[model samples]
Target: MADSTVKNTYVKQQITDAMLNLLRTNELKAISISHLVAAAEVSRISFYRNYTEKEDVLREYINTLILGWHVEYENSDKKSEEEMLGSLFAHFSKHGDFYLLLSQRNLFHLLKEVLKTLYGPKPEYPNFGAYVAAYFSYGLFGWIEEWFARGMQESAEDITILLKNRK
Candidate 1:
């Protein structure tokens, strides 16, 4: 069981790496499964076993990054809104290159999709709480989208300061 989990993780990592590398020079639409599998050094069977489509690889990678951020945020002992904002900006800044690439490729929607998955309205939430969650998520996503559109000129710290001051 452990071996199977390890193998799956390895394959997924390979696919994610290959997809990111390919997206560096190639449009996502231009990338084919054969090319992706060959670049990943994994067989088609392995690719199919891990993912159904090329976009899935990117989505999975984005999800992993977001989940990583979530874990860090949860464990950081952030007690203030400013600290939380700092953590958020820092994480996004750390991966600015990949995010920028996604923006350039018109694939920022993938990030938005992941954010929706994380913060979208939930069945468990009351009606008001669900709308509030969706509202906050969409608003936060809009800010990030604008930052990317602006070429990310401001440093992460600068962003944290700006938002912190706005409150």
Candidate 2:
């Protein structure tokens, strides 16, 4: 990798780690740019150059996670809804600390925004496929949010079974 690319990645990672740490104990709206930069050990300019706002850091991290999961999902033999959901639950379970923090902080809505971006019913489009995709995304998000709410106590297989048996 180029020098600048490596530096930029380092800066972004620093900011992301700082944001997550802050979100653990502080409210999202309460954290200021000054506090974030101080916690991140990066300059304000660095933060602004890489991210427009605080939420962008969290959004980018979530996007990275979803992208990783997408790659795994693509590679796995997850042809059915049960298989796909089982994979998803396992992924979230592995990252339970980060996700549990988001749940505690009431930040799961950001996941919905990221999902919409990836599978959108674009505001201008009038198509059944778009609506179907959007509906599916929303429904999946509902399951994820509820799973987080329940402290993710159940095993992924158990949750998949529950979803399969839902009336």
Candidate 3:
């Protein structure tokens, strides 16, 4: 029983890793069950045993990423607002291709849901503060996209400085 459980876990991880790799090279829409199974070196039956569809795998992947981020931040000492923003930006920057793929329309909605789960409900800010936070998140995503587009021209520190100084 233990061995079977271990095998199941390994298979799931393999599928997840395969999907991530495909996302790195292709748009999310281009990923299919056949491609995932082939990449994972598993049969279609094995893939279905773990996930019903590609979106299921992608949902699980996003959830895992968000949960991992939550744990990392939860374990750390208090961080300033700037530090928090920088850390979040750094996380997305590290996964540049993944973020780029996820920044698309449908996937970005899912990303926002994951962010809400990780960070809780958006804070209540008065007037312009709310607009600022919204723009901050949008701008942060834009900056990361620009980095990936330009082959990461500036360092994360430079981007963080730019974000901080944005009026």
Best by TM-score: 1
Model 1, 1-167: lDDT tens digits are: 99999999998889889899999999998999999989999999999997888888888889989999989899877968678778877888999999999999999999999988888888999999999989877877887889999998898889888877775
What are the candidates' C-alpha RMSDs? 1.5, 1.8, 4.2
* Residue 112, candidate 2: C-alpha displacement in angstroms: 0.7
- Report the alpha-carbon TM-score of model 2 versus the true structure: 0.91
**Reference-based lDDT, each prediction:** 0.89, 0.88, 0.72
Instruction: Say which prediction, candidate 2 or candidate 3, comes out ahead on TM-score.
Output: 2
- Each candidate's number of clashing pairs is 0, 0, 0
* Per-residue accuracy of model 2 over 1-167 as CA lDDT, tens digit each: 69999999999999999998999889999999999999999999999999898889988999999889989898987789789888888888888999889889888899889878877677766798778888878988898899889888798889999988986
Better of 1 and 3 by TM-score: 1
Show model 3 residue runs off by greater than 4 Å: 24-26, 100-110, 120-151
Candidate 3 lDDT (Cα, whole model)?
Answer: 0.72
Error of 2 at 22 (Å): 1.4
lDDT of 2: 0.88
lDDT of 1: 0.89
Tens digit per residue, CA lDDT, model 3, 1-167 = 99989998889989988987887778777887888889998889988887777878878887887678767876888487667767766777677667666664246556665554444335666767666666656655556556666666676677778878986
Clashing pairs in 1: none
